[model samples]
Target: MDAMIPLAQFLWLAGALLAAGLATGILAGLFGIGGGAIIVPVLFEVFAAVGVAPELRMHLAVGTSLAIIIPTALRSYAAHRARSAVRADALRRWALPVVLGVVAGTALASVSPDRVLKFAFVAFAALMSGRLLFGRDHWTLGEQLPGRALMSAYGFGVGLSSPLIGISGGGIASVIMTLYRVPIHQAIATSAGLGVLIAIPGALGYVLGGWPHMAELPPLSLGYVSVPGAVLVGSVATLAAPLGARLAHAFTKRQLEVAFGLYLLIVGARFAWQLVA
Candidate 1:
C-alpha cells in the first residue's frame, strides 16, 4: 500500500500515456516503426514527472518503450503484410542476424552509460533524417540487395543500433531496403516486421540490464520496464495502428519520406539539445 502512487496522479499519467499511445500507433503504422522513438521521449517526461531518478530515467524510458512496442509492431506488420507490401524473402534472410545483433546490443546495455546511449540515439536519428530529407533516388549502394554476408551485416547493424535508440529497427531497416531499390511501401512494410524482431529481445534485455537498478525505479516496474506504461500505451497503440497503415498507403512516396524526415529531424534535435544542455 505504501508503494502505490496517488490515484489522482496515476489517472493523470494514464491520460498522458493513452494520448501518447494513439500518436505512437499512428506513427508506427505510417513509418513502419514500433513507435519506440515516440515512446522513449514520452516516457522520459512521464518518469521525470513522477520523480524517477535521473540516472535511471533513460533506461526506464527505453525499456518501457520496447515493451509497449511489441503489440504495435505486430499490428503494423500484419496490416502491411495483408496489403502484400512486405518483402518476405528479405525478412527471412535478416531474421537470424537481427536476433543475434539484438542479443549483443542487450549485453552492451548492461555496461554502457546512459550518455552513450543518448549519443547513439542522436547520431542515428540524425543520419536517418538526413538520408530521407536529402538523399536522391540515384543514390544507392546497389540496384539490388547484396549477398548473404552483406545482408547479415546490415541486419546486425540495425539490431545493434535499435536498442541504443529505443527503436525496433524499423527506421534503419526501411532506410537500408530503400537504398537497394525496394519500393518505399515495400521497404516500410518489411521494416515493420523488423520491429517484431527487435522489440521482443530488446525489452527482455532492458529488463535484465536494469535489474540491478531496481531500487531507483518506480513502483510496478519490471527492472527498467514499466508494466503500467506498457499496458496503458500498448492498448491504444494497437487499435490506432491499422488506421495509420491505411493512411500510409494513401500518401505518396516522397510525401512519406518528407514527413518521416521532418519528424525524425525534430526528435533528433530535441535529444541533441538535451545532451548539450
Candidate 2:
C-alpha cells in the first residue's frame, strides 16, 4: 500500500501525475532517465502535501512511480524499436542478470527505511545526472562495448539501483553504454528497452511486497501503486513517449547532452533545496 490522501488531494495528485508522466516519458525517451529523476522528487512533494507520513513518503513515491512507468516505457521501447535504434544483442545478453537484479532491488527496498531511500534517490540522481552532463566529451572504458560478463554486471547494477530510486535503469545504462563507445542514440534506445525491463518486474515487485500495508494506502491502491494514478499518468505518458522518440531523432548528441545536463542541474538544485528544508 502507498500513501493515503483525501479526495481533494487525490485530484491534485492525479493532475500532477499526468503532467509528470508527460514530461517524464519524453525525458525518458530523449535522455534515458526512465522518468524517475523527475517523478521521484515531484511525488515526494505531492505526497508530502497530501499528508503522507514523512517516513513513508519516499517508499510510496518510488513504488507508485514504478507503476506508472510500465506503459510509458513500453511506448518508448516500441518507438525505439521501430527506428531500429535498440542494441538487441546487448539487451539479450543483459536480460537475465537484470531481472535478477530487479528482484534484489525490490527486496532491499521492502526492508529499507524511508529516509535512506529518499537520500539514496537524491544521491543517485545527482551522480547519474552529473555523469551525463559533465563527464568527458568522449570517454571510453574500452574501445568497444564491454564483454558479456562485464555488460551483465553493468546491467545488474542498473537494475538493482534503478528501482531503489524509482527509475527504469536507463539513466545508468545509457551512461555506461555511451562511455563504452556505443552510439549515443543506440544507447538511448536500448535504455528505453531496459526501461521496459525495469518497469514490468519492478512494478510487480512493489505491488507484491507492499500489499500488506493497506491501512496506510489510499483507496484503490494495489500495494504501493494508486491504480487511478497509474491509469491517469500512463495514458498521457504512453502517448507522449513516441513523440519524444521522434523528437530525439531531430537533435544532435551534443545538443541532447546539453539539454539533459541543464535538466539535471535543475533537478539537483531542487534536491539541494530539499536537503536543507
Best by lDDT: 1
Candidate 1 per-residue lDDT over residues 149-192, each given as its tens digit: 99999999999888877888887787788889999899989999
How far does residue 20 in candidate 1 sit from its true spot (Å)?
A: 2.7
TM-score of 2: 0.82
How do the predictions measure up, each by TM-score? 0.85, 0.82
Instruction: Give candidate 2 misplaced runs (Cα > 4 Å).
Output: 1-9, 15-34, 237-277
Q: Ten residues in a row with the worst lDDT in model 1?
A: 1-10
Checking candidate 2 for backbone clashes, the offending pairs are 1-223
TM-score of model 1 vs. true structure: 0.85
Task: For each candidate in the order shown, give its overall lDDT on alpha carbons.
Answer: 0.83, 0.78
- The reply for model 1, stretches above 4 Å from the true place, is 1-12, 23-34, 79-85, 239-256
